[model samples]
Target: MSDSLFRLDAAQLAELIRSREVSPVEVVQAHLDRIGGVDPQVNAIVTVAPDALNAAKAAEAAVMAGEPLGPLHGVPFTAKDSIDTAGVPTQRGSPIFRGRTPARDATSVARMKAAGGILLAKTNLPEFSYWIESDNLLSGRSNNPWDLARTPGGSSGGEAAAIAAGMSPLGLGTDLAISVRGPAAQTGITSLKPTHGRVPMTGIWPRAPRRFWHVGPMARSVRDVALAFSLLAGPDGQDAFATIAGRAEVGAGPQSDRPLRVGWMVGPGFGPVDPEVVATVRAAAEALATFGVQVEPVGIPALERDFALDVFNRLHVMEMKPAFREATRGHEGEMYRMAKTMLSLPDTSMADFIDAEQAAERLRDGYADYFSRFDALITQVLPIPAHHHGADKFAIDGQEVDATYLQGATVPLNVTGLPGLSMRFGTSRSGMPINVQLVGAWHAEATILHVASLLESVSPVQGLFPNI
Candidate 1:
């Protein structure tokens, strides 16, 4: 029973707990036990919440007492270590902030707890949450649950790995470029990067250039991601950018009665994608088409005109360097590779910075143009499946590219503040997970999630878990 409990998704656990069929203590203990047994190999969990069972006991008491239960009542969830967890260590994957614990939860974490979600643990991340892999000097590197030698993708890699390995049912992760979606794709889980500012960034680190950063949920199922996003969205009045009011109505089908129009693409703008990935995107598009939705191959001219990854590089380095500098001050020796690499990069030239800013606007306008004609977009989340750890270069589809190319299909969503969902849809020849990205217009999370749910019904890889 405990083994099956560890395998259940958050929604399923919540229902069982609410109905008294499964005690909160049993559910939480099952995950805790799973973590103890598996984490030595995965290294996904940074610190298990010492009071997790206590919280679960309290939730169980509420269930027995006939108290109103939250959506995630008694369900254990983890968060990337970069997100603050009151009294739990959030070391930001660096020795510089080792043993650091926050007095307050980040808005997302607090919201999750308010929804009756138990804080199961905090997961790993790259130093300062800046790299494409979840490895740092403080907590060491996290390995892919499917293939230990491969990365799970980062900076939310640990959260992804943990959820994939059944250590947690749902988790929170932050995304600047591809942290949330990329990691989810790698680990064969589901994740939602809600429209920018849809969720507050309060209590999360590297607050600079906050416009691009997002806090979102990572889970094993689309419904769980949708449930968590509904609970986590809206303003805390603390993050100025989070002024959007009211929760996004998840599970809401398209706003209109018309057939949803979705465009799928893999090239011209997203860079050299693996043929396997391209096929996966096409398969998803075709799957949707057969499901009575209008799906077609499409491209956004703005993506081609201005490579979003390059534009993001020029703009963010100038805006984000200060915060990195402030955090790494006098602690350079303790910093990890990403921090050192970020600090060593030369500042963006004034001309290039201005050009990049204009390019960003143009990209946004281009997306606006495309969205006006389409309800959503489908694309590859990453160029390829999870790569080996520490690899920096690859020959993808006959073109030699660097690791940064992995963000090609993902960064544009960040630049435009659009919402995107990553979910497994195919498998690589090497037996790794392959995921297709579902993108929606700003504040159109429901639309994309609706489409994702539809696709989830037909996903080739549905119910597939890593062989951890």
Candidate 2:
């Protein structure tokens, strides 16, 4: 029962706890034990919440007392180190902020707790949460559970690794470009990057580029992600960007009367993708087609004209560099690869920044136009499967590309403030996970999640967990 408890998703745990079949303490202890046993190899958890068991005891009391329960009542959840957890060290994955504990939880974390979820631990991330890999000066690095030699994917890599390894069933991760989704893809888990502004960013780091930053849920199942999203979304009043009031219902796919329309693409705008990755995207589209959904291969002209990655780089660097400079002012010696790299990059020229802004608008317009005809889009989450640690260049499908190429299909969503779900749908020949991105127009998280649930039912890689 203890071993099986660690394997259950958050929803399942909640059901068991509510039914008195499993005590909250038992469920939380199982995950804590799992972390103790698995984290040494994964290096995913940075700091376990000292009061985790105590919180579980309190939750158990609630169940015993017959108190009203929240949706995630008694389930344990982990968060990236970059997200604040009151009294727990948030360190931001850098030595400069080591031992820095926040006085309050981030809006996402607070909401999770409010829903009766236990804060299990804080996960690892790259220095300043800026890289695509989760290595940092303070907590070392995180390895993919699927292949220890390869990375889980960065910034939110630790959260992804933890959930994949069964250390935590549900977790919170922030995505600027590919932090949440890329890591989820590499780890063979499911993650949701809800429409921008859907979740508040209060108490999270690197808020300078707040427009692109998003806080969302990473979990083992699409329904768990959807459950977490429903609880996490809406205005907290503290974040000016989180203007959407109340919890927006996760849409129930396309209206029951009409079939959903989806477009699948892998190139031209997103750069050269590996053949396997392309095949995975095609398979997802084909699966949707067989489900009676309108599926077609399509391209967005604006993405071809104004590459979203280039636009993101220009706009973000100008805004993000200042925050990095301010944070690392006196602690430059403690900085790691990503911070140093970001600091060394040239600032965008005024003219170039303006051009990039226009490009971003164009990208948004292009997505709007696409959504006008299609309800969602399908694309490869990464150009290739998880790569070895420290790899910065790759020969993807005969084209030499930099590491940033991994964000090709993902950055456009950030640029357009759209929502996307990343879930495992295929496996590479080498046995690594290959995930496809499910994209929805702004505020259409429900629609994408609905489609993702459909894909989840038909995914060829269903119930496949890492051998770890």
Candidate 3:
């Protein structure tokens, strides 16, 4: 396995390497070379490890010695910068914590290593992982893999761009507010924001997104995502948020998917979605019908005001205040700067936060009720494809909408603690990738992955890259 090997998914490469058909060294080299080539243009990855080769060699020796294998067995992947990697310069995409190193790997990182996955790099993200753009003082900005002028979508933008460009076969991304799914949509990749709390966020920043954040896999295909996810998910004692949820098992035998009831929500739960986005999603729904899925257009009134508006934003803003203070100490940086902009508003009253939580409970109950009726929910991640770099808000067919409310259909799921998968469906008229999200009931990742796996097979999203 040299740097020439960019096309194999995490599972494919791991199996070959486990059988000695390929070496970890080759896989590491392939990724490094790929990054060296296209990363300069896409800016997807911020840090490159010169010692990744050494780690691969060590893993290769263990394999040669006939040692017991871990789940990943020497696969390579990247992590969102917000997650701590022992000894890595995890700056959290800001200058305040620039060059900061944790003495121990985060619980998730340690688990991945325990499963035999190697950290190839730390991906770029927005300052504090709070914004749509993956730009900051430390790692700079990550551009879309398809077009340099557009965003890759944050705060997991770098991971999505890298995975899309085949720089890494798989990677770990944290999604709170569409950080993972939005990037998947923008860059034409596959990602999962697992059932909230399914994966631990031991070393990630803002800690506020904990209840909202999900650490999941970003890859070239549904199978790759499934493989990566199986390795990273589980309960680690360190994460209070990691509840006792059942982890989805990868297919070890002849497992067949069952016919599913899919409720497709197009508009009104949010705003006017782009005709192109609607058309692309509708086409995929038709394709899934051939796979024995009942894809019916439906409306969801739960997410309407049940999730609440300014109250929902305030809930997040209030939770972030303490973390922001801890990071900045006393001065104004991007993290603090953004924090002040939100916290400066005395208008965000304590009553609002309490009311939002009450509303969130109602939204949760509504989702739970809805799931009892349908196997999964199909919707858009972004109202449209990734916007131009300088565009302020997303507009659908000349109608303007807030970036947070529209582009990210992810917030409500977080509010309800459900699972969501971001699957690339097609390219937009501008030639950028478009993605649709499939949301499942709490702890129903197997069902969500099944639908994603089925749709990935039939839709135009099937160009799972060649050896990049």
Candidate 4:
């Protein structure tokens, strides 16, 4: 096996293909081979595309025949099981949809393929993409690339694990609050959640997240993320949220002559955070200062701990009932019980939905005001590193917190419908990834990506190498 080929970044492979130094088929084959080597132990991929090799061959033919190519031409990537893939079974890590395969690729998958990317496999996710841990009846569980007994984090855990293990350079992962960002943090990959409507949420599972869910790129490098964003950002007619993709897309804004100003919350609307996580956030901010940016702590008292948790739980309970109510009635046992609990809550009535929407609006307005003054917001993707596998609850700084708190640094963005990104800040002692988020103004992912690129350059969060 050519280890170097599997290890090459998407941009590196693109350069080689563009220079006629390597064929697209060769690049795609390398990723397939990488999956073969590592995916068994990790169980990150649920369904492999038998025709990926053929697709890559066709891409090579296109290049050889002098056809127009997309920016990610010949890059190999994966999609989360929750996202539809044509001709591939999208089990969504649930038995309820066991034999389900869409007649069409998801808007995101179609966009990636159209951009010259080869979709090799469908990655695993939690059942119905509901829980934080990535395990389900149909696809089973995904283990962390660094530690098998530990979680890679979910519902995009499989995507994160595969990318971290070099099974693929990039994967399409969705985030309601922190699925993409959280898993990326746990597995040592980088991701960007474009503004809610910037990318189409069509074909993403639980389909109810139309209001808050965002589908975006998970990659090993910031540049790869930017490249993925470019491919995935175009308008798709099926999605209602996507408005004017032509203008919503990211690119170089006016070149800044002044060092950027950064405002970071010590924690979320919460008071104190884990020492290690706070250290990581502080270290990340200090690292940014060295990049010639002004870093200062900014507080969002309105978005405080209780309020953030309230927003997260209310949204989860209210929004997810429709997606899982049917599944619970049919499916039995633990997973069914979990879904029941989410649906069983009383605070999720029609009035509650309206209230949540109103609260979401207020939250959005708050972020608008917050971003009005600051160029970027820096914060922890979570209060601490990955907990034991399948653990329901955790504590930050000795205070008991629930799974909802896991979305601490993340929920506000979702509530307000703003774009926020999480990238690897550093690594925890256990080799778990410590990550930070950069929340920019509404559609200003370019600024956040720019600063994240700066942080990625200095952090010890190295992209995974191929074990194949």
Candidate 5:
């Protein structure tokens, strides 16, 4: 029964809690037990909230008293360690901020709690949440739950791993390049990187150059992501960029019976993709077609120019380097290797940043034009499945590729400030999860999520659990 409790999705857990079939205390304890049993092997959760059980007790009391409950009432959720959690430590995966605790919850965390979600723990990330792998001086390395020796994908790797391993039902993770979606793909879960600024960034660490940064949910199901997104969206008064409208009805909308046009791509555009990864995406496209959706292989010529990653890298360095230099001015030795490598490099010149911004505009315009025709674009989240841990270089289908190419498919949506989602569509020959990305125009989360929800109904990887 405890195992069954940990296996339920957040929405299912909430329903059970609301119906008195399962107490909030029982739900929270089941997850805590799962974490205790499995997290040692994965190192996904860095810090467990000391008051989680107490919060669950209170939630149970609310149920017993016949109080009105929120959407996620009694559902346990985790957040990336870089997200502020009020009294809980948010170490940002660095020894530099080891014991740091924010005085206030991040806007997303507050919203989740307000919706009756219990904060369970802080998951791991790369130092300063900068790298594609979740490892740092503060909390060691997080192993992939599926393979144990491979990466789960990063900066949000631990968030994905925890959810995939059933240690938590749902959680929040920030994306700049591929943090949320890539990790979800690798771990066989689901995630949404809402259009930039759709959710508030207040209280999240490394919060500069807000245009490309976004925070959204990572969960076992697409509906769970939509539910969390509905609650997390909208202006928080503190984050200037979060002044957009919310899409709370996205998940609840009826599935369309009308034929939809879908575009699919495997790139000469993004980078070299593994044969298995391409096949997985193609299979998912075929599945959509089977549902009366018109699917076609399409290409975006701009993606061939590869401006997406360049735009992200240029702006990211321009915004982060100065602050990083100051933060580690004399404590360089205390920082992680990746942080040292990044901060020691030359900074992006104003002229270079200006050029990148211009290119970003072109990238956005290109996607806007393309989405004007297609309902949504589908592609690989990463070129390959989860790779071996601590690898310095990657070989895809027997050919070596730059490790940074992992950001290929995901960075483009960030450049456009568009919504993109990832879900496990198939499994690799080695049995690791493979995911596909679904991208839509700005503020088109509803459209993309609706398509994702449809795909979820037929996903080959649905109901599959990691061996961890």
Candidate 6:
């Protein structure tokens, strides 16, 4: 019975705990036991919170005492090391800040705990949370559970890997480019990259350039994502961007009766895409259409120019480099290789910055125009499935491509501050997970989550688990 406990979703555990069917301690212990059994092979978790079991006991007492329970009461969740946790070490996968523990939890983490969720552990990530793979000088690399030789994607790879492998039922991961969504794609799970600033960034590392950064929920199901999102959203009085604009209902909404017009694409648009990935995305669209969604093939002309990636590169290097360089000043030698490389790049000139900003405006307008016509746009989360470990480049249908192309499909949504949910659709011939992105207009997370819930009902990867 304890062995099967890890297979239950966050909602299931919460329901059991609420009805006194399963004690909180049992649920938390099952995950800890699972982590003990699998983490040596996966390397997804960096630090197991020492107080987790004590908290679970407290939660159990609350249940027995008949105290009111929060939505996720007694459930356990993990967080990418980039996000701050009050007592747990948040090394951010860099040796420079090893043993560093924040004074208070990040808004998202604190909020989750307030809702009765226990902090199970801290997961791995790229050094300084700056790259697309979770490997660092501090905790080592995190391997995909599906095939130990492949990557789980990043900078939230560890979060996705932990959830997919059943070490944790839900988690919080930060997204800049494809950090959250891409990893969710690489691993066979689901993640929500809420509209930029929908969640607070108060205690996260390298807090400057708060524009593109986002803190979001990742889990085995879209319903869990929505449940976490509802708790994390709204102004925290710290993040100016998180100001309320009126919230969108998640599972319950009037849009269910009306057919949702969704635009689907697999391209010549976001650079060269793997053939299998393209086929899987089309199949996912068809599955949604079966549920009465108005799914159609549509192209965003600006994406064909690959302007999204270009814009993000220009802005990122300009905005992030200085702060990163300052943070690693004397500790440069201790940082990850990618962090050093990013800092050594040439500075962006005013002319290039202006040009890139203009291009960004165009990309935002393009998505705005598209959303005006369709309820959402469905596309590939990554052009390819999880590539082998240490691969600097991968081939798509016999053509070689740079590793950075991993973020091609996801950067546009970041630049536009649009919400996107990356959920499993199918599996590759090699058996790696395949995911598609459901993008909605700014602050349309509920709409996208609603659509995703419908997609989840018939997901090809639904009920599947990694053999690990």
State how far residue 256 of model 2 sits from its true place (Å): 5.9
Better-scoring candidate (TM-score), 4 or 6? 6
lDDT score, candidate 1, position 283: 92
lDDT of 5 at 271: 74
Collision pairs in model 1: none
Q: If candidate 4 were superposed on the true structure by all CA atoms, what would the RMSD be?
A: 2.3
Q: Give all TM-scores, in the order shown.
A: 0.99, 0.99, 0.94, 0.94, 0.97, 0.98
Greater-lDDT candidate between 2 and 5 = 2
Give candidate 6 misplaced runs (Cα > 4 Å).
245-250, 253-258
Which pairs clash inside model 5?
A: none
Worst 10 residues of 1 by lDDT: 245-254
Ten-residue region with minimum lDDT total, candidate 2: 245-254
Better of 2 and 6 by TM-score: 2
lDDT of 5 by residue, 170-277 (tens): 999999889999999989999999989899999997886677788999999888999999999999888998888777554433345666788999876687899988
Per-model C-alpha lDDT, please? 0.92, 0.92, 0.78, 0.80, 0.89, 0.89
Off by over 4 Å in 3: 1-4, 250-258, 307-311, 333-340, 464-468
**Quick one: RMSD of model 1?**
0.9
Q: Which digits, one per residue and each the tens of the lDDT, describe model 3 over residues 1-468?
A: 454468777888888888998888888888888888888888878777556888899999999999998867778888888888887778787888778887778877787788888889989888888778888777677888778888888889998889888888888888776788889888888898888778888877767846777788898888877766776677788788786655564332113365678888766665678888888878878888997777798776777766434445867777776677677775474553345655564545877778888888888877888877788888888888888785676667788776665544677777777888988887788788888898888878888888888787777757644222
**Candidate 6 lDDT, 45-123, residue by residue in tens:** 9999999999999999999999999999999999999999997898888888989988899999999999999999999
lDDT of 5: 0.89
Sequence-dependent TM-score of model 5: 0.97
- Compare candidates 2 and 5 on TM-score and give the better one: 2
- Model 3: lDDT equals 0.78
Pairs in steric clash, model 3: 1-26, 1-27, 2-26, 2-30, 3-29, 3-30, 4-30
